[model samples]
Target: MADTTADGVERRLPTDEARELLALVRDIAHREIAPHAAEEEAAGRFPRALFALLSRSGLLGLPYDPEYGGGGQPYEVYLQVLEELAAARLTVGLGVSVHTLSCHALAGFGTEEQRAAHLPAMLGGGLLGAYCLSEPSAGSDAAALRTRAVREADGGWVIDGTKAWITHGGIADFCTVMARTGGPGARGVTAFLVPGDAPGLSAAPPERKMGMKGSPTAQLHFDGVRVGGDRLLGAEGQGFAIALDALDSGRLGIAACAVGLAQAALDAAVSYARERRQFGRPIGDFQGLRFLLADMATAVEAGRALYLEAARLRDEGRAFGRCAAMAKLFCTDAVMRVTTDAVQVLGGYGYTADFPVERYLREAKMLQIVEGTNQIQRVVIARHLVGPESR
Candidate 1:
């Protein structure tokens, strides 16, 4: 059974250990993350040291196999930990999520020898990772990706392509990349584990964004980057399948981050409303503002519940792609609404950098676009409900 807090939110953690883990995450967030979030973000500094701390604390590999130095926690527990981190800083939360996504291909489909050789170092050895699936022309239609990997006479592969919108692109130690190996379309693709410093691999400058500037997003170019056959993650022509499978879980991670962001915005608004004087009393005492707070709180709770439901399904080894899409679509939409309302609650202060709501609003917009756009999510859900559309 889970526990209920004074804030009226019920955490449905399955074990006491999970509860303790959440408490530890909160302690870290309050002590180490929150205090530096605004400053680091404003300065556009990536907190590599903070990621090292998380890795040392066994947080960077929370949901993988314990044999590989992972914590072996379920997705439910892992995601709640993400929520706590995201509440402190979205850069940290989303960075962790992307790192985990980068590990999915090898962890799930690699040969035993490959897993034994790479999983431990990748999972908990202080090495960060990036996922390379989206390209300049293949954001929504991922099947149309044009990156090519040609096999060499020596059983090596030489890859050539550009991957765009890659989180942690320049800083990651490794990348799980997908590229064309055969014909056109998804069936031609294959997955590989590429070292970030491999010759011919380089990152373009990071994109200047509205928020989360502390996290780098850039385009990665594979200019004839070569890797041995041993680096192939799964069977040929299976890269698209592997990529979609990873995104199903990655969407849940994004959903958890969105809920955390919304919760943070709500907390900021409520705290300000309770102390800020309006006319003669606290602004929170007014029914109009109070109702707004109520709605924001409700949305946060609802989004959390939705993601947890999808996570539980994932942990049960059930098919959860549609649920994951729904959670991502709804939670991100909720964050945009809640953050905007939080700005309204703070009036002019929210619009300024003095308050974090403005930044929250900016960050919330990216969640709706990443993993998959909300429109793409709707198409996925509709396909699940009624079969694929006619060609």
Candidate 2:
């Protein structure tokens, strides 16, 4: 209900509740996260310890029901916390997002029996989970997934085939897997909770990736892995819809990460322009360069606005899928543009690992590809505007 002009002063500072929570996030990100980001990223290490710290800090379950050891914060607030973590390090933020996405099926549609059984470890962050919707054959066409889960004589199911591009694949305690159970297309799909260490469940070597290196990606092989009927999330034929719903939220998380990455890039660019000397003058003194910084900063703010708007819609329990797609497309492209220009603003220095800009550039790239590619986002937006029944 209140707004503030540019500069540190606020016409209305956040409410006491919001400010307190955001402060906690900032403290953790600046003190605990910023210090180790570069080193872990350089070493390509998955920070299992960092996740535990986040869990202890009450962040791992920030938007879930408190009955399950969660913080019960609104998505609007939770997303801001994610943004701050991402500004410090994209890997940890993305890992949190993936973990949250993995919890969606169980939380949204699971039976009371299922929730009671799984939500404690998941919401408590004692164990991490991966959402397995993408397969070797089904990246964007998720309904086309080829993996199968056949009912066995014992009334259990045996899962077969592989899931590709799974984040946290090697380290996740379990996976929310989608497999074919009926006829072809979306109607055939069912969701299963498959443990990572289950017999016949193995991860391929971590993928050689472009960025978010500290967050590993791999293929999960399921060679007749067995799961109880109780492990199935929701009823048969609902998995595809559930997967898309999860992504609607997951894409918003990616959008927030992009905003944070853009903000970090803008900060670096501003600092560099102010301090770096060019022709016996600060680069900030040059209007040509200063304008670029202005644009980057503007994009950062705009991206924030976009994600926050979508998040608010989500919190209101409104239809926000189209908004999520728009946020993902715009925010990630903005991050790419801003980080690339941040490098240009710093000249040769930005191109090197000596500064974080290069890393930011590399990191911004995956934001476009993950959580559905920007191209896919455009298609989603187009569909929503024209309506599915439209010609």
TM-score each candidate: 0.99, 0.96
lDDT, candidate 1, 104-204, per-residue tens:
99999999999999989988899999999999999999999999999999999999999999999899999999999999988999999999999999999
lDDT of each: 0.95, 0.88
Off by over 4 Å in 2: 1-15, 389-391
> After aligning candidate 1 to the native by TM-score, how far in Å is the CA of 350 from where it should be?
0.7
Tens digit of per-residue lDDT, candidate 2, span 287-326: 9998898888889888888888898899899999999999
Consecutive 10-residue window with the lowest summed lDDT within model 1: 1-10
Runs in model 1 deviating more than 4 A are 4-8
The lowest-lDDT stretch of 10 consecutive residues in candidate 2 is 4-13
